[model samples]
Each structure stands twice: as C-alpha cells, then as structure tokens.
Target: MPNLKHLLLLSCLGLSPACIDVPPLEDPPKEDPADPDADFTFTATPAQEQVLPGGTLDCDVRLAWADTTGGAVTWSLVSPPAGIELQPFTLPKGETRATLSIRLGAGTEPGAYTLTLQGKSGTVTKQATVSVTVGKAGDLVVNWVVPTPGKAYTRGPLLLQFTVEGGAAEQVEILKDTTVLVKPTGSPYSFTWDTTSEAEGTYQLSIRATRGGAVFTSAPRTVIVDRTAPTVASFLPAKDAVTVGVRDSIQVTFSEPMNPLSVTEAAVGLKTGAGDAIAKSVALSADGQTLTVTPLSDLTAPSTVQVDLTAAAGALTDLAGNGVASAPAWSFSVPTWLPMGGAVSAVGGATSTESVVLKLDHDDRPILAWAESDGSSKNIYVSRWNGESWFMLGAPLSGFSAIGTNAATPTLAIDTAGEPVVAWGETTGNGDERTVFVRRWTGTTWESLPSPTPPSSLDTLFNPSLTITSDNTINLFTSLYDTAGYSIICYQHSNQAASWQQPWELHDDPYLFNPGAPVSTTSGGNIFVAATVFDDHTSKRNIAVYKGKEPYLGGTTLGNSSTTPSIGADSNGRPWVAWSEFDSAPQSDGQIFWARWEGSSWTAPVAVNTRATGNSTPSLALAKGGPHVLTWSGIIDSERSILVSQWSANSWQTMNAPLNALSAAGTPATAPSVALNSTAQPFVAWTEADASAASIYVVRINR
Candidate 1:
C-alpha cells in the first residue's frame, strides 16, 4: 500500500494493477456496422406510374442501386396502406437492378396514389417515391367527313370513320335518330350514307358500343342534310331583256345538276304573245346543268316570248329528287326590229363638230372623241359607257384651237391593243405655220410624238384619221390643204417606234376631193379607204376606194357631188359607203344616201332620208355578223335632230327619234357616231348644235 498521493496518481492513470504489469497490449479486432452510404437509383426516371382496374401498370420501370455492404436489398410500397401489389419486392443479393411491377384492384380510387420503395444492403437502406394517377377511359369515337359543323352541307354521300377506344370492340353502331348508319364489329369502321332521298333538315348522331354485357353511348354529334330544290342560275334572253337578236336560242342554266331526262319537251315550253311554239328538241349540256330548247322556227324580232320552267316534281327533279324552287315564267322582248333605243345624256354643253368619232367595240360598247369649247380653248374630250351612263376618261387634252391657232380637227381610232390614238392639226405661229400633232393613250397617260410635219409650213393638215391595225401598223390618213385646196396625205409608223416615215400623198392632185379624210378601216387584206373625186371638167362626183399602196382606187361609184362620205366594212370584208349627197328634189339640199360594195361593183345608191330638208355627215358602222348602223343629222318635223337607220337582210329600218324627248327638242344634233357592244346594243353619240353653243350627247340602246 502507498500513501494517499500515490493512490491518486494511480487513479489518474485509470489502469488496473494487472494492466500495469502487462507489456504493451495489442489493438482490439474491428467490428462491421450498418451501411449508411448505400444509395437507390433508377436506370431511367421512375415512370409516372398508372394501372387499369385489375390490370398491371402499362410501363416497365427499372430500380437500380449500389451498396458497399454485402447484403440483399428490398423494395416495398409505404402508401395506399394496402390494395397495391409491387412485384419482385426484394432486390436479392447479386442483383444490381430490380424491375418494379404494380397491379391495381377494381376498388382502387382514380386519384393520385404514392408508392414508397426501400432497398437495403446489410445495414444500409435507401428510399424512392413513385406517384401515379388514374382516369376514366374512352370507348367509341365517331367522326364525319361530310355534314361537318358550321358549314353549308348539301344532299350527298356522307362519310364517317369510327375509332374504337378501350371498350368492347366486338359490336359498334353509329345512328342518326335510331337509324343505323354503320354497324360493324371491327376496330376501323367506315360508312357512307346517301342523303339523296332524304329531306333537308338538321338531326343528331351518336355512337353505341357493347362491351360484354355492358353498353356505352358516345356524346351526341350534329348532322345536317340539305336536299333543297334547284333554281335558275341564269337564263339567256334574260328577264325584262330588250334588243335580243331575231335568231337566238332559249338557254337555261340550272343552279345544280339535274336529271337529264327531266329536261324534256313536256317539262319546259316556250310561248309567244300569240301562241305556243313547238320545241323541235330539248338538249341537256354535258354537265347536265344547262338545258337548251330548239324551236321549230327561228325566233324573230317584233315578238315577245315567255319561258316556262316546269314545276312538276318528276318533270324537273334534281339528282336529290327535288323540283325547281319555283316554276318561274320569264319574259324577254325581241327588239321591235333593229335601230331601237332610248335617250342618252349629252356631253359638253352642245357645240361639237363632225370631229366626233364613234367606235363600237367587240363588246358592243361605244367610245367617242370630239373637240369642244370649254369657254376658253377648244380642248378634246373622250367618253365611254360603263354599262349604264357615259363616263369621261382622262382629263381634257390640248387641242390646236386652245392656243388661238387655226382649226382643231380631232380624230380618233382604237387599236387591237386597247390603246386609243388621237391626232389633230394646229397652227403654232402667225406665219404660214401648221403641224399635225399625234399622241397615244399609254395605258396611263398620253405620250406625244414629234410633229408629223415641220412646226412651220405653208400647207395645213387637218382631219387626222388615226388607225392602228391588228399587226400594230399605225397609219394616219389626213387632208393637206393649201391655197390650191385639199390633197390626200398619209403618214406611216409602227406602234412600237417613235419615228414616222416621210409624209407622202396618196392623191396629190388638188382637184380631187379626199372625201371626209378617206375614212379607212383595217378590215381587209389591205387598208380600205373610201375616197371621192370631183371631175370639174364633167362636174360629176365619184366615190372611190383607196388601197394602202400605189393602185389607189379599187372601185368607184359615179354619182352627184358628195360631202363627208363615211365607210365601214363588215366582218366578211364587205365594204359599205354612205354619204350626204346634193339632192335636186330640194334644190341642192343634202340627202342621206347609202350604197354597198359588192365584191365586183357598187350597188345602186339607196336614199335613206328624203323627207328631211337637210341631212349630212353619215357615220357608218358594221358589225361582225350583225346589222349595219347608219347615223346622221337632218331636219325632222322642222326640228334638227339626230337620226339613225339600220340595214339588215337587204331591208332598211328607221329608229325612234333620239331627241324626241330632249328639252331642246329642236336642237340640231350633228356628227352622229354609232358603236355596237357584245350584246349588239347600239351606242350613239352626237353634238347638240345650238345657235348659242354646242355640246355632246350620248345614248345607249341596251339589250
């Protein structure tokens, strides 16, 4: 035993007497602990898990992990307390990856279900969370190609396609108001329903499917069937129409395809004001849309006919088994004859000259150009019919008279290219000075070319008649006058070039009369111009035709002195000449006379106006296969008015007095020009020659 201090020292060492006696002790053996570093991972992201009732999850999920401790791992669900089954719940030893498969029972609620999984290697453990949601499944889906919503559905074949969802695909049916449109037992079901025999209306459609002993019906879908009757889309010789030709056939176009056999003689008929005309035959168009009726005799003028479309069901039924919307009786009046029209508006105030040019286009619309006084200068103006009234085109253009020059003789002609070429004569300075200015409508603005003649010249060129042929040959026929009087002149160029050939004289002899600037047209192989010559030695007037080249006169007609002679050629190249001649009946007063040029010679002159005390300046117009329109000015009933006459089938007919209803009824209407549109409607334009002022007037004789 030691003292107390010795005992305290021994206690501080905290060793037993036996330990102090032993030499250095060896280290104790190490003990293995639970593995806390073990981790759970996924080869791919844990899928948003789901399963059908009594079915396994549709996705395959792999749960992978690594553990340092040598032991097996386990996987289990912690939520949904019980009901859910996880397959291969344990990741046994040597298994780095384990597949998790789950099954849900019918009683499982369709909501989010959380599944907790755990894995352990020896004493190490890890957890993972998997959440899943459930939903009600779809069964049968019905889709329609025809009768789609918010569209104009017509009576026709209706197409439908069916998609079978996770339901009993053994039996499926699509119905419209209990009528089965499709009944099949397959996954891809398609059906076509012909509504040709169904009445037009709206209805509901649904799909029914049977799964074992249960049944499912889809939501309702809307369907519409339109079986409406056809209507008259348009009719030739339309309702309330006028100026219809004498040899027109009755044509009726329906709104839709019709039964070809339905358009028979008994189904449709035509009746004149007097009695019914038998139909020779009824023909349907290739499309089964248009019905044409052949009459026993040709339809002529001065007759009114009514078209009767049958209302009987089978007579005019469409493919949809419906008759026309209504049995419309339409009436169109054939012109009492030719040369029939009403009043048209006046241009300017009234003062226009023989310079007024009228061109009848292929559409039968009339275009005009003239010189007028706007209180200051004589500016040129042009107007065209916009189907209703005359619409002025472009701004008033410059005329020679505007600058205090000599006379402004404006002339116009249109090319096949749709460009209007206008030319005029003006004296620029005080001395022997005059030039023929030419310009063209460049589709937008007028482009002026160099003067045809020197700015200063002794001779004056007037009555500039411009013509552009189909081949774009620009020809200018004018009257060059000096102290010796009128000479026929011509200037040539192309519409594509700015330069004109040297001015040449067609009839350079001053003694010959280039009647009305040799009115020329592009209707023949060579340009045709109607010219006149006065034999001072014989004192007889002769109407002559000039060709484009050296041999000037093709033919000539011996007659009394003629003034302002006009010429026109029909589509057949038949030339017609009309002019105001010196009449001895009224002691040298003007008389309107016309003559036709046969291929061999001229026909004897036919007097158009004898009763009129004075008549002059005949404007001639001929249609391709239509009528001959002749317009002029004369005194009718002691009042100066514009007059018109038509020659057709070797017959001449007078028209209603154009100025018969004008406020200035007695106003002298001169320089009458005529043009015919595609409808064979006549458009007449003239100058109101009042003592105080002159203005332009227009009228459209529509059909």
Candidate 2:
C-alpha cells in the first residue's frame, strides 16, 4: 500500500477506482381534468371596397382565448386570403385577447375571403368571412423617340401617335407653341401630332375618353416641333470682349427683324450656361437691339449664356420672307486664361496619373523639356536641358486658391513662329469652379486669353485636346456638362488672333458623360475626333470616334469590352488606346492592355504586361520613325514603381526602368504623364511620394 496522499493521487488519475456515488431525487405529477372546452375564437371586420390603383385597405381582426375547462389553450390562424399577409398578433396568456392585421397586394382580384381560427386544447375551430372588390380601368401606353436629338425638327416631318384602350374618348388635342394643332380623329379615341408647318420646342397632346357615362383623361404626351432656322439670338455681355465682372447687358439682335407681335414674355428669354432661365424682370430696349437680362438673383460674371427669341415661334419672319422656323440656339462663353510663360523656353506637364509629356520648343536652343501635374493644380511648369544645364519655367500653379491648387490638362502647340500656345483648364472662381483657358507667349510676356471658354454643355473644360491641320487651323476640343442627361464635347478653331472661333457643340448624348479629352487628326478632308466616353447605361468607358466638321461624331467602341485608360495617335494617323483587362475576381490586379485602329476596324486588344498580379493606368506615345512606347506605374514584387515598355517588331518588349525606389507600403507612384519633344525623345512626368510630402518628378527616355 502507498501513502494516503499518493494513494489519493493515483485514484484521482483513475488507476483503479475513481468514481463517486450519490442518490437521485423524484418529482410528483398532478392529475388531468375534463377535456378543455374550445375557448379560442376570432372574427374579422368587413373591409370597404377598393377601386383599382387606390390606397391599401386597413383591415383588422379580434381574437380571444379562454380556459373554459381550466386547461391551457392556444390560438392559431386556420384560413387566410390569397395575396394577403397578416401581421403580428397580441394574444394574452389565460383570458387572452389578440388583434390581427392584414395587407392586400395591388394585384388582388375581386373576391370574398373566409378566415378561420383554430383552438387547441386539442383541436377546435371557428371561422368568419370578409369581402374585397378590385375593379378594372383601361390604360394608356406612350412611346416616343427624337430622330434627331436636340435638333427637334430639322428634316422630314415631326410625327407623334398615341393609342388608348378602354371606352370611347373625346376631345383629343396635340399642342405645340401653346396652340392646339391636332384634334381627335373621327373615332374620337386616338390622336396624331403632325408638325408639317409648326415650330419646335416641347409640344403636349392631351385627350379625354368617356365610357359608361364616366370620363377618363389620358396623360399628356410631348412632341417637339422644329420648323425654324437656327439663329444667334444673344451674345453675352463680355462679347464686347471685355474682361469679366463689368456690369453689362446681354446683346441680342435677331437674324431678321422680329415680329413686334411675337416678342412677348413667353417668346423672348435669357438663360445661363447652366440652363436656368433669367427671371421675368428682363428689361428690353424698345429698339430691340439689346436686351438687359438680370437674373432673379445677383449674377456671377464669366458665365455662358443663350438668348432665345420667340420670334421663331410663328411670330417673326427673316429678311428672305421665310417664317422663323426653329428657335435659335446661340451659345456664348466667359473668357478665362492662364497668364504665364515666356519665349517658348520649355513645355510639358503630367496631365494626370496616367498621362506623361515631353515638350520640345521650336526655338533654336538645344533645350529638352517636359511638363506634368497631378489633379488639383493648374500650373504647367517647364524644365529645359540645354545640353549642360537644366532650367525650369514658372512655378507650379496652385489650384486658384490664394495658393492655387487644381491644374488643368495642359497641352502645348507651337505656332510656325515658335510662339507657344498653352491650352488648359484652370480654376476660375473659388466657388463656381473650373474653366478652359489658353495663353500665348507674345514675344515679351505670357498673356491670358478670354476664358471660361466652354466647348459644349457636357465638357469639363480640362484635358484640352489640340490638332493643327496642315493649313495651321488649330482645332481644339474639350468636354462640358449639360443639365440634361449627357455630357458634350465643344469645338473651336483659330488661325490668327489668340481668340478662338465661335464654339460649337460636338457630342451630346444622354448616355455619354465626362468624355475624355478629345484626340483629333485630319486625314484627307475628314476631321476625326476620338474620345473616351463614360456610358451612363453600361457604367463603362467607351471610345466614341466621330468624323467630319460637325460638333459630334458617330462614336465607336474599341477593345475587349473594357473601359479605356488612355488614348493617342501617331504621325501615320493610327489611333492607339490602352486600358485594363477584365478581371474575373474583384480586387484582382488589372493587366495593361493596348489596341490599334487600322483605318477600318479597331484591332483586338493585346496584353502589354501579363502579370497575374497587376498593372494599370497606361499612357502611350509614338515617334514618327520608331516603335511605340507605353508607360505606367504598376506593382512589382509588391512594390509600386514606374514601368515602361515598347512595342517593336510586332511584339512588346519587357519593361526595365523603375522611377521610384522608396518602400512601396504607404507611398503611391501614380498618374504617369508623357510627352514627345522636337528630337523625338520621350519625356515622362508624374507625382511621387517624397518621404513626407508629394512632389512632381520627370524622366526622359529615348525610343
């Protein structure tokens, strides 16, 4: 035998016997009484009849339960109506009372419902009935499309037709210009709007149908009438071409003398670039040469404007005896400009994280320069390498704060004389914000041109695009926003004065918004504008390419059904696009992709960087005589660095240069911007992490 402690420890370890024993307890059961009487009962209140397309019925039911035989009782629903749902019930425990609520869906048909209540001491039931009526009324269907968007009536005829089903109706009328044009057909049931002779805006057709001594009126449908010639009804005050903020009136003279009869409160109007109409207190000169349009509120200077003349609405006639057919749509803009630069020393700025620039001036100096900036700043500073020394032009512009921050996409083009014309977007006001501005190096000092120049209602006025035709006619394109659904691109031309030609709207679609800066080139007699369009429906970026001098081009999408990242063209007029490939998994890295337009169709996209990991935001550049270079900042070895690759011999070459060497954890090297200089050398600009702050950096690489 072991010691007591050791023996106890061994027992605890279950060596032989480690069990303990105790006694169990028992409880008593009570006797059962006579079967519990059926005491649970429920009843529903009658619901009022409801017509179709009316409010929901507020229905309720009373429920009660009792222990008639002193036995526990429960309540339950046994019957319910189709399409009806009952809400929670408040039932008591012993002498329980409860309320039940029900909701009927809209599609419920006319019918009676039987509701039942079940009591379970065992099984007993009680039931009641309720009735609801769902009646029917006919419907009117509407369908319409503008053959020509925004133009309203330009060619052919304006036709509108409506159909209604139910009982015979009367009094069908189609209204345009506030006067009824189309009346009910002989059937008195349908209507058609034919604008063979009327002018256009918005026309409404209203009808009333009657059946069984009751009348139902169909909702009004709108038809646009276009019969008038487009006119320049008004020019904004600064059309005096004066600096903004000068107290001035809008100058609006008609294309022809107005009908003193048609220029009423409804016919003549003034509106902002934003589409908000000037208030009713508009003051007009009796001679009608100028109209002083004051806003209902204090106005902001440098705003775009449109002056409309009701004279086109069958009220005025042109000098040629033609009735003014279409309401004139004239657009005017506030001039804004960037005011710095000198003697074309250097040019280029990173347009964004995905763009780069290398600008070479026409000046004889052997200076190599580049420009690039991140979002939120307006300065396009230039750096020059004159073989032995490097010189920087102006300091980067802050957007326009007392410290100016946001910089526009600055594009540089040198006139034949080596004078540099800088086109870009800049902050015009602290609150209203952003304008497309231009500046020229006028032999002595950099001068600002008239600004707030809007290309289209849909344009953002940044990311300017410029193309100098063989004739030196500079064609510029930018993006604008409209109150209506789509964004637009505006076009302007200039050859002599720094002033741009009257701007024209190019692309305006309810489906396209924030189109990328335009890229253009003239081939033969056709002008081509290729831009990135953010499709509202697909929520993806599409490349919309249009041809001709028309403001907008018919757009075509390119690549593997993915949004594009950047686009460019070479001297041969071949357009190039770079974008990210579609990734099957979210959060997966996107691969760099490229596509080319071969004069007929867009080539299928080829993977430029085939990393399962990821690379993105690619920018492309091409020198007339060599391979195309595509550069971007991407992640490698879990680090973010600037990468460049070239397309040569029908294939992509591996990228080797790394612009940033900092730890990749918190630092971001993004928005790779690129440009090509006079010698065909490519210069790239970008914003990089500088230990504690952010700074703009550049690198030049030969192709």
Q: What is the TM-score of each candidate against the true structure?
A: 0.53, 0.43
The residue-by-residue lDDT of candidate 2 on 1-703, one tens digit each, is 1123223333333221101111111112232356545455555543232223222433445545433433444444555556555553434334333434445556655444444544455565555555444445343221111111111222223334343333344444544445656565653122223345554455555444445555544334444444444354645653334233323455555553332323445656767778887764444454433444554554444466666665445554332123555655455544221101222222234233323344455653322222334444435654454553556544542334444455546656555566555666666655544676666566555666556455444434656765555565666766565534334454555556556777765546666666665665554445677666776767777666666444333244654435435656677676677766555566356677777777777677677744424566667766677667777767766767667777777877854545563444766676566655556555565556535444445555422
Off by over 4 Å in 2: 1-356, 363-380, 394-405, 430-432, 455-460, 507-514, 517-528, 535-539, 548-555, 560-565, 581-588, 661-667, 677-680
Q: What is the lDDT of residue 32 in candidate 2?
A: 35
Q: Please give the distance, in angstroms, between residue 417's alpha carbon in candidate 2 and its true position after superposition.
A: 3.4
Worst 10 residues of 1 by lDDT: 16-25
lDDT values for all models: 0.62, 0.50
Put down candidate 1 lDDT per residue, 512-584, tens digits, no spaces.
Answer: 5534456777674567777777755446766666666544443344457776778777777777788788756
Clash count per candidate: 13, 62
